[model samples]
Target: MKQMQIYAFDMNCVSHINHGMWTHPRDTSLQYTDLDYWVDFARTAERGKLDGIFLADVVGVYDVYKGSAAPVIETGAQIPVNDPLMPISAMAYATRHLGFGVTANTTYEAPYLLARRMSTLDHLTKGRIGWNIVTGYLDSAARAMGFEKLPEHDARYDAAEEYLEILYKLWEGSWDDDAVLADRARAIFADASKVRAVRHNGTYYKMEGIHLAQPSPQRTPLLFQAGSSARGQDFAARHAECVFIATPNPQAARPIVGALRCKAEAFGRGANALRVLGLITIVVGRSEKEARDKLEDYRRHASVEASLAHYSASTGVDFSKYSLDEPIEQRSTNANQSALAAITKEASKPVTLRGIIDQMVLGSRMRPIVGSAEQVADRLAEWVSDAGVDGFNLARTVAPESLRDFVDLVVPVLQERRLFKADYAEGPLRQKLFGGRGRLPSSHPAAAFRT
Candidate 1:
């Protein structure tokens, strides 16, 4: 049996994927600003032997729901968000093996500057880093950056391709494997000849510079892509090592996973070139009834309106305009096409306003797996077998408590069943997740730029 990888989905805000759960009395996600909160989170995840804590981020508010940001602000749905990159060093200092997958939008920042920042983080975390590549999904983010609207969906992906190519040159081509000499007697710090400046005159960007930082343990951090659109999957096929997907259930997940693997194979990469992780939420307790009771408790506080607000931002469609019974019509938006597809094309039923509310348990549309430890383990194994996924990115119902329960109760059962690892594999994140290799494989596009 293949051991499954697990990552905890989180964000640096009071509310993340689970929109209204921050209002839960016990939820401490608002402590997101404090370094101790992240340090504690890293420690707990490491204790559970989780593969990584993937932090999702958004630069704009969910104003699309009601033509204003008020609903989002009033409900505290993913607003007042902090920078995901800032907490990494502190969290890295606190844990040994837990990887940090920080979200950074390639749509806004320049490739050269972003490359330096990631390399610096790679050095700080000792290569325990992965980048969740996203092109900004919200129009507000574009306006904030002085653009009237975001670049067209496919157009953004085009820019990202060029952006990634430049990054590859800087990270893998510019610095030779042994550019740093540190010769004491000869008084030479580096072999200048071994380091070369990269020049890119691409359609979207122009650059001529050597990477500011020296090569880290992993020249390129592990690449994690969450694009679920058709073009998005093509990008993932060529670039991503791990792919994050949002499917509503196992029935929906199987075909999507198959399609992504097929696309990867078509791109000349192996069928298993990408590791697919589906998004899910779990609610566990000592007894099945206890878990159900806890589910009811969490559901009581979940705000359906906040859930709609979140969905509105991701798909660029406001549920507010439609009647409760009205059927949703999916349209092309500047936002995430994959997000919309998850509800419409991927789901077994048509998405409606009232139907959308019914899906919100603990403030998100992802249906929760509620059971005892043994039952939860069985369900997870079944998901791996039936859905053809490597693992899950588990969303939170409460704060550390949800994660704490999983680590304490669910992890032990998984380890006992040989579905989860007791001890972490030694090496950088890429090695631990894929194999004992700290860099992208030869099949990956980034490797083509290697010196």
Candidate 2:
């Protein structure tokens, strides 16, 4: 029996992946600004023994459609977003077991600054932190950062490679494990000789300093990346411990999962070095009929315009300019390459404006699973077996109610089938997830930086 991991995929805003279902009466996403909401959510996820709550974020608005942010703003799509890092400490305090995977873009934030923040959180959470690495694709973000245009797709990753190497030097190399000695007589907090400055001069970044904070449980937070393009997968293969893929079905996921593992093996990380998680949304209930009814009810609040606006930003193609049956031009842009390829070159069927709208009827490209707990479990087990993924990242539909239902209703069935854990394992996030040491293993490239 293969065990599966699960994460509650969400954002620090009213609308995330599902587009426009926040208007549902039971949805509590509107209260995202409230500390209580996040704290409570962490508690709930912990109670259900969820592995983690993966928080997605963006630095810019979805302004691609009609070249304006009006539609997204009007629908309250994802514009009113807050910082994903803000609620993490509060959430960690509220729960002992739930891990946090927060998205932070490498393109916009400095490696030196990010390493300290992640180390601080790992210390606070007792090593319950993971970083979802992303490079910005939004022109709006570039504009905000004083750049006239975004860097080319592959060039961003090139810079990221250097960014990561710098982080590795700071996080893994700067401090020796035995440097800290709380010798009462000597009164030495840290051995000055054992700690050294990490200096680097590269094409993309330069830094000369010792790490500000001592090493946390995981000297480096668990690395995660969602890049399905050839270049993106190569980057993920070289760095990510966990890779996220959003495919329509298990079949579509199979080859990508294989590629990720194969690439990891080529890098000498072994085939099991990476855990792949497929993006999914489930609306499970006590019975099949009840689940179907709930899906219909939730579908009533779907915001097609908001979904299109979000998709436009994702693919860097304005759906507003195309007619219903007009073919979408799959032009290369600084945006997400996989997002564009998924609907154009790699699509299972001919994709057009009409097809895109049809897919978004349920909010995003993914089709939600509506079934009894047993049926849902069966589907998930099949997903693991056929897709070769280790788990699924559950996207939210109606906020707390949707997650609450899955935890209360579907978890037990999966547990019974031995597909999900009955309780969390002991240790820091890395130890719990992959077992063994809390720090990067010697085989990992980051370990090369270790003294």
Candidate 3:
């Protein structure tokens, strides 16, 4: 079997995917403000031979439940989040081969400015940066940005399509590969004739100038998308190099993954071009009993209120209004459609507030693997084969401890079974992932814009 790629999933905040876990005595998430915390985390991931660290982000507070932010603020449910891009350079400096995928929403940001920011990071990191594109899903975020209300769900995706086009023009089309001629004696940094301006007047954005920065290591950063809705899937099929998915079971994911791959192929991309990675949380230890005990201990710290706040914000449904035994009504909402779909279509049965809270006991709905090293490795292999997924994005249940356990226990077993790499590869993030140096594949749309 081919070695499975693993991304240590995290966010620059006290609370990320697993909300309210900051109260866990063993969790060091509260130290997110310290630069050394992230740098140390990056180095640890590199030592474990993990593929990268994927940092998730959100531009707004979780204010949907009861139309207020107090619940989230009180629980620290992803509130007081720091900027993900700020500490990435420091982390890059600490590790040689760990890739960084930082999420930035396109809805509120200007395309030109975001393009410059990503390019600058690409240059500084020597091409270890990737961007996870997201459209804002919170009405509070839109209102905070001075918009009257959030755009419709499908409309947001439409705007994103145009947003990406403008970025591609700036990143891939503005400068030629040979445009930069750094001959000190000649004193010519670039050939003006080779560099051209890109002009586009679209429904969502308008740009009329050359790209601001010189081409970085990868003209276009590796594209990642986490959209599972119909429109969202269409956007991913057109542009995403890697698609992030969260499913409750492999049986549930099979149809969705198949549909996505088929859609990408229909859009003229090879089936393998879009790598799919499912979210996972593992609790592995030296023995099965030890793993179970660890999980039980972690459960005691999980905050039910914090989980409800997060769920309410993500689905645009206030759980406070419904009884614990009340079945959550399936309806279309302006929030994250993928999240809503997961609860309704992917779950075994209709979800109630009680069921949601029960699942939240460990913070997230991702299935946890609790066993010895060999047992954990066997289950991971089963997931890879049965789900047809390329890899797993391991979510942190407790700060460095969750990662430490996996590295110390499961990694060795995976290595012994020849299912995980034992050392770093020799180049930029793209080169390490795809076995080539610099930029995207020729078949990718971004390549067409290259000068």
Best by lDDT: 2
lDDT of 3 at 342: 71
Best by TM-score: 2
TM-score of each: 0.98, 0.98, 0.97
Candidates sorted by TM-score, best first: 2, 1, 3
The reply for model 3, stretches above 4 Å from the true place, is 345-348
- Model 2: weakest 10-residue lDDT segment is 357-366
TM accuracy, model 1: 0.98
Question: What are the lDDT figures for the candidates, one per model?
Answer: 0.89, 0.91, 0.87
How would the candidate models be sorted by lDDT, starting from the highest? Answer: 2, 1, 3
RMSD, every candidate, angstroms:
1.2, 1.0, 1.3
lDDT of 3 at 420: 90
Compose the digit string of candidate 3's lDDT tens values, residues 100-172.
Answer: 9999999998999999999999999999999999997999999999999999998999999889999999999
Better of 2 and 3 by TM-score: 2
What is the C-alpha RMSD, rounded to one decimal, of candidate 2? 1.0
Q: Which stretches of candidate 2 lie over 4 Å from their true place?
A: none
